[model samples]
Target: MKIVREARHRISELGKAAAYSKFGTDVARRILASPADSVVHKYVKTKGLEGSVRRLASESLPPGLYFAKLTIKQWEKHRGKPFRLLQGSSVVYGNEVEPPARGFPLEYRNIVVTSSDVTEFKLDINAPYELKIGRGAFTTPQQVKYDAQYGVKQYGDVFYSLRGNTVNPKKLLITFPGFGPSTSRISYAVSYLKDIKEADLRDTMMVCFQDRYLAAGSYMMVDSAGRSLYERVWSVLDGLRSEHNIDESQMLFFGASKGGSIAINYAKDFPQAHLLLAVPQMNLPYYFNKPFFRDNLFRNNAIRSSEQPESLLRQYFAEGRKIDYFYTNSDELSNHSLIELAHDVPNLTKYRVDGGHSAVARAALPSMLGIMRNFLHGAKNKTFRCENIRSYARGGNVLAQARVDNQASKIRGANWYLEGSLGRTKFMHLLTEHSYQFLKFTSDSQVLAAAYDPIEAMSGLTALEANGSRWTSSLPEPLTRGPKQSPGAVLSFDELVLTSTSPREYVVLDGDTHGKYRYRSYEVDPAGDTMEVHFVKDAALSVDTMLEANGKNRTSYVAVVEPLANWNLADLVALRFVIKAGAERLRIVLHDSSKRQMAMALLSQVDWKNSQVVAASPTQPEANGTSSAALHEKEALLSNAR
Candidate 1:
């Protein structure tokens, strides 16, 4: 156990060390100069006698030559006006405001800036300097001396690097790494090309950047100097493409969390830019309440008034953004981000992988690599899913077969990784001898396995347990795999489809929600017309809407979707209730556009052994335009529960 933990720690260290090694971006082009010695910043130019005093690193005035004010202020006055920086007494020097008459500061005094700009302001003393600036969002480095004391290097501005073959490549993969432990160093998430050996990428360029802001790092597109990190990233990409003559179709952006946000934002304007993002927070300002972010990054005027790529995702997707978004099914916040925005993504691929937020990378990275390899080799689009993992008892061992839906594609080579609760990893290339294949393993400990197939798509982490009961699930119809053969139907952002959904089902809510985040992922609130549903714990769905029964309480997880108050659903509506596995029964009340209950249906879990009906006939509408259906408690999926 100790060895396993120690191994993980060592691997982590190696990852950090990688930044300073061969994988490091070229730092020769520094965006913001490393803080120079003996420099004071953020001195306010005051119009009056006594203004707000700004202090420097070393406060004691040990007798210095002449005072040179850094004169830091935003260039725009309509955007914002100017302020004053005072040393001791105001000595006018043109419209530059007044500085202490030269050669006077031989004693202890902090620098002063007249005017209130609550953003991060810096002050230092040569003999005491003045700072003058107007209102505008800006960013400055935290005290360099303090950062250096911890042996952590810090860069104050957005920095990026472009490196790779840049020759004859199939696609250029732009990787945006997630947040680092600190914003001090430039972060690089895993670069797929480094591990790839395909002939196509031997000449493609990989670009990455640093989060110029602090704490959870940067907002990706905004820098403190009021520069558009968004425009800059695009410009860099355009330059590279122009220089290399690469087509737009051959570009891809990859990132998760913070990196995911940037990757999504960068490709917004460019419809051809493909995105592979995992568990990304759609809104940047959402994290501002955290002390670190609030103190260092969000408070700046530049950040507050900057062009937010925050919620523009809906607009981008509305204008045809091809995004492959991945999120852990159990993570409510990330999932909610998707539910709130523009509906019906043009070509969006969603993966409801197992585990929490941290586990997204494990699923996304391997899948990303496979997609990259596919693009390089000109492979068809394919997605492999572990549709089921059931425990089959043979002798005293519980054998499990992970039914992988390969979409009937030809498999060239497949590799699988298995890890036990103790952190032991095993690899295999098991061949499918029959339509159903079971991997044999029997133990009291927990185990997870991933079939890392290097195809157009792959599966996320799946777990198996020993001595667990077995169950079977039956689909009502053939599952649709969106390819050239069958048409794929997409549910819009405004559409009321959660998780795995079919085209035969649809619903209309009463109202719309704009910029309101009142409910968490665990809370199911169908307030007014908009539906806000969240899973309790491990429940989640991506592409489908069918739900299996829970042995304890299928109704324990309640979802309330709002209904229209005056529109009839008959003209455009399809609805049904289907349950599998353990759900005892489910009762749904039919509603007219006027929000009146007309009929009801009760669905029970399929009892394959008895071959019994799992669905109930809808009750006839009541004469008063309202109907009620009741189910016995013992046989109910949701009898009295709301």
Candidate 2:
């Protein structure tokens, strides 16, 4: 046993040395800048912080700078007493309470005590509580003692690496594999966990282990086993924390696929730790009981039971729970799970993108970083809702922006179109398996919308169709039809335009919003086919009515929209919108004229509903109405002439 333990330690050291040997001197210096104080180290010295450090380590990477040891400990025992067996009946044919009926005539029995043993390996590091430092590994072995406390038991292997520099205090991310039936193959989790920790992230450490093989992918085990494993993990974490000064918040739990489920389970048990996971099998029952996947029991073991995913989620309501779920629209395992969870847990955030089973690499990582950054920076509520839409709009130049809201629900980010750009204004928003692209155009009204890879089109938003169409409409209304009614008609901001009297002032001669109001404009265009309009508004601004014009000319018109309630426009008053006469206009027959024209013409007249335009006929003085067009940039505004 000593020899085996010694060999494992030597191998670990050798591996570390080899890794260090590969780095340039500069890189090596960066990794080993300076060692920080560790609560775990002190705890280990007094054996006081073992459990705490172990607890912290289970969820995070060690903070500051440090190294860790991955070692195996053997847990076994022997029983000296003879074990007894139960026979069918007691026969007293011969005498002396005939030796309990052996089998048939002359069947013999021997007394022997059944013995059981288990193996558990621990991976750890000593660090401050604020910066949990340590690694842990676990796995299920084949042919484990059937009567063992936990059906299948074995600890995984943990590997260590440095993160963060003297300049930046780092956070640790520790990953746990879903299930494994052996120690050898289970170590794969450890290797990959370390690799991912090294990329892109600067001030973070990663610790992980391979999953043990269970049939094929089954990782579920009896509750007793899970508890025992959890306890062992908890013990190591306790030790690390008591000895090290690692803060619970600095530690993060991250995992993917089967590992992701493991991460969630750990966080559910220990809510104080920061948790991050992608495409976790939260709904394990659905995964295992599926008729099509009936043959697999290996990975299924780690997430055993035929219960609903809701039942599994119910296990996480212990006191204070903070967990983040990342899933791709293509992730069959977690896509729906995330949505369902999103509805219930306010703190639960579902990061959706475009991708499949391998959601982490394709979708979760890139998007997750932004979320983690917010979390690490002490963001309140820390939960963000994201959607896709163009946010950058500077007279044709548009960039994608990520819209986020604070705890008070106040929005943050530049305004472009569609109420903060539907939260998809940045490259960070993941809406299914695709990573959204922020778009901008140098001149045209066009903006870019793209994904990392192909994905199903959003329900209301169509995927790029034939000839690369930007959007496909599915609503019952005409996919390309204009608003049926004005005044009462609700239209999106992009659908309306306000003529700018100056660069900073605007009047709505034609708009879908209700109310007579003035607005502050950020931009104006008079030379292009499409003029850009940016304005500040209040509730009083609104559209009155949109009317379709009769006649083969196919021209449309609209009426002056009145406010539901009167309002005050302190700075700019009224509005005038410039549009591609037909694009933003509706076909409407207004009292103003029999001929069809742009909706702006009817809306610009104060008595647009009662006045009429004479076609070469003498106009009656009573037919005249008040005109507010000249007050603003009527030059850019549509004319009342039909």
| Alpha-carbon shift of residue 515 in model 1 (angstroms) | 16
- What stretches of model 1 exceed 4 Å from their correct place? 1-158, 167-170, 183-193, 197-200, 213-216, 304-310, 339-344, 380-492, 495-642
Query: What is the TM-score of each predicted model, taking all chains together?
Result: 0.42, 0.35
Worst 10 residues of 2 by lDDT: 109-118
**Candidate 1 residue 50 C-alpha distance from true site, Å:** 40
Off by over 4 Å in 2: 1-171, 178-187, 191-205, 213-228, 290-293, 296-320, 335-341, 372-642
| Residue-by-residue lDDT tens digits, candidate 2, 162-251 | 343313435545665543222222222332432232333465544443333221233322221222244545554544444445567777
lDDT of 2: 0.32
Per candidate, the number of residue pairs that clash is 37, 142
**For candidate 1, lDDT tens digit of each residue in 195-266?**
555344566776655553322345566543334566666777777777777787788887777777777777
lDDT of each: 0.37, 0.32
